[model samples]
Target chain A: MTRPVTSTDVARRAGVSQSAVSRAFSQGASIAPETRRKVLEAAAELNYRPNRIPAIMLSGRSRMVGVVVGGLSNPFYASTLECLATSLRAAGLQILLVHVDDALTLDSALDQLLSYRVDAVVTALAIGSQRAARMLSDLAIPVICFNSRLTGPWISTVVSNNHAAGLTAAQVFESCGVTRPAWLAGPVRNAASRARGHGFIAGVRANSARWPDGVLEMRGDDSYESGYDAIRRLLARGERPDGLFSSNDLMACGAMDALRQHGSLNCPDNVVMMGYDNIPQAGWHAYGLTSFDQQVDCLVDAATQLLDAALGPDGGPVSRTRVVDARLVTRRSTARLI
Target chain B: MTRPVTSTDVARRAGVSQSAVSRAFSQGASIAPETRRKVLEAAAELNYRPNRIPAIMLSGRSRMVGVVVGGLSNPFYASTLECLATSLRAAGLQILLVHVDDALTLDSALDQLLSYRVDAVVTALAIGSQRAARMLSDLAIPVICFNSRLTGPWISTVVSNNHAAGLTAAQVFESCGVTRPAWLAGPVRNAASRARGHGFIAGVRANSARWPDGVLEMRGDDSYESGYDAIRRLLARGERPDGLFSSNDLMACGAMDALRQHGSLNCPDNVVMMGYDNIPQAGWHAYGLTSFDQQVDCLVDAATQLLDAALGPDGGPVSRTRVVDARLVTRRSTARLI
Candidate 1:
């Protein structure tokens, strides 16, 4: 019924320049507190709210970020997403979420995200292609790769020390005096998965009696069924792995089931299971799965803060990698030692 | 270095109206296939991309939907979100996701979403206030409520037959011929949870000689620990429940663990467990939880399609509800029969 009031109207009423009015509404903008108060008072009286688009347009920024996440089936990712989404929203940025159901669909999701002039791109999926990183970097888009190894200087990354986690799994199993050991890995080329598996092998070589020959390697599709099947196949052999290390909590859950139904073996009595990513279920009285905690919330928060800096004080984009420590949570399922 | 080509430029080259070009790129838009093919060829030859915002502005629509979801802590929500997001995208729309952590913060999230004039609002959270629904409807905003009852004629809803799911749980337990049966319910006021509990009670009253008192009732925080503690409390009583029905899979898993460690009771032999919402974990060998399947993908597809029709030729917003059937998934944990 009436013309909508603008920053100009507020500026005139407050006896301040339009730029001052803009500064008053913009967070971290430079303006005198008294002038800001005056502008806000006038704007409120006139029932005027600043349009969100103009400020972003003036700054040549979208104030939006694209987040590509996969593995929603995993509780760890699902939990981490809550924190990540909240942290970004708190920073005054909106998240355009893209879900990648599978590896092939992941690239397409990334491409769809790239079509937008997003301030930054974050991915829970691993980035294996150096070319992809370079292309995003060329577009002046800051890319944050989560739970993946940094391959080149073009992309930034944050990950738990999967390599060390692997070693911990192996040592925990060895301390339990397991005669046979196996490591179940997800997807052959995932940097994080590979790191965890290699770390376990390295640890086994350092402490176990059977260096290379005794260590068994199992590949999984990162599903509970994969862990279930891997164990079923492992038992078909003359010797069964007394200790098994699963790359993630989901697979570890499967391995635990396999021990119960297939082998009719009891956990921590005849066998022990260790998993990475101490998801909420790890503490559930049902499983009490001993696993490594990735400190996902902390990592995601740090990544969000870094993206903020990259957009502002840090200048365009800088490539760096940060690895956080993974803590071992000792629970009943992995409580056995000798 | 050159200015980005616009839809207008492509429109001119293709000898078509700009509106036609816009509709050609828009999915589900009424445009000729021949015109769409010509537009694509012209756009490709000129290396043009329609600016993401201009078309939306021209149509006076954001082509974006605001999704309000709570209980991301539940695997069911995360699993459903992927399908919902994809379905929306395929229909030429974008999603703005808001996570409702608590009721107090829900209003603020809604306020922010409303500021954008989103084409519609879809929520998985319960809308308790009639005034809130009326306000949105007055603004010509179509509200799609998931897993909630239709409170008013202004709101549309999609939900599983929670009542049927409850009855299924009770029948399965009765067939197992348990001396004592118990039902675990979520928040006392949640309509879906209440529907499930009442249905279970009704079924027990019909089938079992125990009638009302013998069918024990338990309430939980809908967490694994809550289920764990619920079972512990039930066992502390002189007569432990021989059959347990958890409102959700998470709590059931906890109940199962409590049976093994806390009571030294065996599954399917000493006690039988049935859960609702057969999440991915229910099928895992460790739990083998017999649960009700909500058919999330089908439900999500139906919701998306409803939103489409509401926005298109379907005319004015209609307050209606659709209920999808919940099928019983039989598993090892609930295999024992009388």
Candidate 2:
């Protein structure tokens, strides 16, 4: 076996002090250009990978970030986690992914996170109740939620304007000359779901007729079937809504299936469906569901910024809300151009 | 601010040597019951966390496992990762998740994994391409792939019995008296896809003209649209198959959508559609796609065992293959009640 190269080996080969070798690798550490070049050459020849010990001793920077995420079953969360992981890697920090199952609460997950003493935690919409946010706050840990608003005095939240996003979807339908609208809502208890439902109602009222008394509101897990069931129940009620708005794309996809099953749901026809969080599946030719493209890049940027701020010199600002904008992505599902 | 506790404080409070305090925390380290109790009491009072320093010193045994997963878009991989993360956590190991994007080759991801020097590397199914298996042979790092099979001396792979799984699906169809069967296959490049296809064909032949002229095969990415397109194309062909077998639940779902679109596919009379990979969507009432369960628990166990073998005292056997059995799950998509 080849001998493992050490700092001493590099110093002896470079004919410089060990401190000079260390300075060449350390960020912002000053060393003469010639000396740095010599150290680099020696280190390269011996294949010396710098042990993380010096970095730990000098600055206590492990350069490793912890990302705790749940609900991988949902494509929206899965995509967000992918983007977040990629962004963190590009920033030269390794991601320690903690996938908490449905049975495990956010508190128990945080216990594991605390054990690692992660530099920061990016909780991408953890499962269960809102109480987890308070637990995260009490830990005095920096947490940045994705699309989940944290109403506390110490944590930062990164989210899209769900209410405005929903309103925008409805307005698009209204501009397209649709008055009767149905909401294929997620669990109505969820904050984002309620906000969007409220906004959609507001948008519809501003246009015409206040959607009458037959504004079908469906509730289920944010799934395609829930959307489908919502539409089915509405159709059974003998109220053919001209416009359908789903809070998320999964439900919208389900609604699309329901439309297909009912037959002849097309442009200027039976009904038009739109959804939020323009998930990747929305682009498929099968669905091509019109939806809102939540500003994923901006959401991720906000999360990264929050993590950075928590590690900043001023002891970090807490209890801040960052909202990224969303735009309507028209598709065949809603029969909206562009 | 509260003063941070150190080992010296624990030793002073416990009235024992610093080494005794260290032994109290270290697993299998010799320490008397009385002294250990005293050290624990002192640690609790001082709020001192142990093993962080020595764990740093032995960073070589950091117990952090790196997982390079491809296809976050697929829910199966997501579930597998969720299980692996939970299992690893339970076993006192940290997970370093590296999401390898579509464009990045497995070799590049493996290189990145090498840089981290993880105790082990776990790759999801998509990563066991021929080129990647060859790279694994040379890397000398502990690698275990889930639901992926790569034939090589140094590599370890855990896969469900695709051939038998396919045969089981066919037999189930045969029992339902379905003669004309069509196969909605996944991409030709994927090993699991091909294996399942081969097994189904074998079963058809074994049944002796139960499915005469073999099952029609359509190839595309393992997605809903692909399944839809495959079935649509198959329907347009000369022989309209009475039964459809989608290689995955997503594609089966698409096939179901397409079948329903044509308004000819019914449970007993027209067609019976079955899919592989019992993804969560398959269970929903909308699709209820009949599919084969991958026996994820068994798959995870094989993966965990392989990882242990690869990193254990013996440094793994020269060559090993672990194949987990699978079961067929009957559902509404193939509502034939076989």
Considering every candidate listed, which one attains the maximal lDDT? 1
Clashing pairs in 2: none
For DockQ, the strongest prediction is 1
Give the DockQ-based CAPRI class for model 1.
acceptable
Best-performing candidate as measured by TM-score: 1
Model 1 lDDT vs. the true structure? 0.76
Across A169-237, the per-residue lDDT of candidate 1 in tens digits comes to: 887886788877888999876778889998998888886455446578889987878888888787777
Q: B115, model 2: CA deviation in Å?
A: 0.8
Off by over 4 Å in 1: A1-51, A103-105, A150-154, A208-214, B1-50, B103-108, B150-154, B207-214, B313-317
Instruction: Please compute DockQ, using alpha carbons, for every candidate against the native two-chain complex.
Output: 0.41, 0.34
Question: TM-scores for all candidates?
Answer: 0.87, 0.80
Give the per-residue lDDT digits (tens) of candidate 2, residues B1-338: 34556789999999999999888876678999999999988876665665354575655566778887767777877777788887777667789888787521245585566346466777665454677666565555577775555656556778788999888878878877787877777776677888999998898888775655787777868877777787778777755777777778888877776777777665435778788878877776557777888977778878788877777777743556788887788876565633
